[model samples]
Target: MEKQLIISVGREFGSGGHVIAEDLAGRFNLPLYDYNLLEHIAEEKDVAHEGLKKYDEKPKSKLFSRTVRGHSNSIQEHVAQMQFDYLRQMANEGKSFVVVGRCAEYILKGNPGLVTIFILGDKDCKVKRVMEKYGLSEREAQQMCKKEDWERKYYHNYFCPGQWGDSRNYDLSVNSSRLGLEKTADMLERFIRTKMQL
Candidate 1:
């Protein structure tokens, strides 16, 4: 039997990383996990989805008061564990899948079928994409990109030992802006197939 393949994509905000993943998933007929993963966690834990959204791709609040620190930390730990458990469960099913962000690459490390990818783009391209997608001004888009990138970095650094987006941590790191989203997707799909020796 062919081994299952799991593609974990870590992407800069506004980098079309999700789009690339979606395309790859479609090509491979694999389920794509992104916000849907959070939704599943929220439902399983009976927590408000909105509350979880605040913690996604973000570090624990450094400004929380001591009184709430314990509660906040507990909640964060629970959520992280839940997500990790779900990812592990999915991997064990031996089904192919494409999971975007939420530290999936780190969580699934050491799995022979795993292919970790990090997607980034030129700052100007990222800003443009964000502005168009969010209907924001250029300046607003630029600020949002920086803030989101920092949050992702902080979250990954906090939860995982390796620096996020370091090529050493990923099997492949591609700049979507250089190749465009469609071409990037094609390139990644081919790369994954090659890596898996399909």
Candidate 2:
């Protein structure tokens, strides 16, 4: 029987990490949990889907401070816990899947047959991709990238309490800029297959 594997991907803004995850899932016929994970949690917890969407991969802002403190536990805390529990349940089921973001690497720590990957790209390449993907000007793309990456870093640190995107946090760190998109996905697929001895 093939070994069950869990692939968790952490990535920088506009780094093609989502594309890479999609490729891997397609190649390996694995289930993918990304934004859809938020939907699932929202439905299961009976929380507002919009609320989950707003806080998804975003750090808490001062604007929400009073709202968060109004409850016994903040919505962000509840959502985080739900995501962690849902991921743990999936892993415990011996499912082979690919999860993008939501701090899967930290949550799935010590799980057998888990491979954590962090993907990053050069600023120029990322900015170009963002400009093309979002139909934005170069300057606009740069600004968006900077702001989103900062938010991602802050969100990860706030939830996981560690250096976001630090090489030490993952099993592999791939420079999508160096390999480009297709090649980077191909490389990661090969690496995961090899690690799983498939």
Candidate 3:
């Protein structure tokens, strides 16, 4: 019985995290769980998939005060927990997967076979990618990147109770800015094989 590989990716926005996950999944024949996870959870929980997308990978601000009480978890908190639950269930069932954000590293922290990686890039590289992908001005892309980064940090702190982007929190942290996409993927693929003793 071989241990399944479960890769949890924490990434900066516009850093090509999803692209790397997709490539890894295709290369390794594993399931990639990104936004599609919301759809699956929505169907399971009878909630609108769009609702999950709206809050997916982000923290509840004052705007969501109604959904994230301190003394107790709210509906949004509950849903997020459910998503984590589903992720674990999938892994326990022997499925190899690449999960994007959603505090997945924290969710599966103690699993010995888990490979946690944080993906980040230089601000200029991220801005350029954002601008090209969304046709935004450089300034606009930079702003969006900063905003998303803050949200990811807040969400992780709230749910995972850990610092975001701290290399200590992850098994590996890769700078896609320096390595570029293909090289980063290749390096990570090799690293995973080495770590798993495959």
lDDT at residue 88 of model 1 (Cα atoms) = 92
Tens-place lDDT per residue, model 1, 134-188, is: 9999999999999999988887887899999999999999999999999999899
Candidate 1 lDDT score relative to the true structure: 0.86
- Give the per-residue lDDT of model 2 (tens digit) for 1-198: 278888999999999999999988888888899878988777887876875776677776655554534552455656667788999998898888999998999999988789999999999999999999999999999999999999989878877955899999999999999989999998888898788788
Best by lDDT: 2
Local distance difference test scores for all models: 0.86, 0.86, 0.84
Worst 10 residues of 2 by lDDT: 64-73
Comparing 1 with 3 on TM-score, the higher-scoring candidate is 3
TM-scores, in order shown?
0.90, 0.90, 0.90
> What TM-score number comes out for model 1?
0.90
Residue 157's lDDT within candidate 2 is 89
Measured with C-alpha atoms, the lDDT of residue 56 in candidate 3 is 71
Candidate 2 has which clashing residue pairs, if any? none
Misplaced by over 4 Å in model 1 are 45-50, 65-74
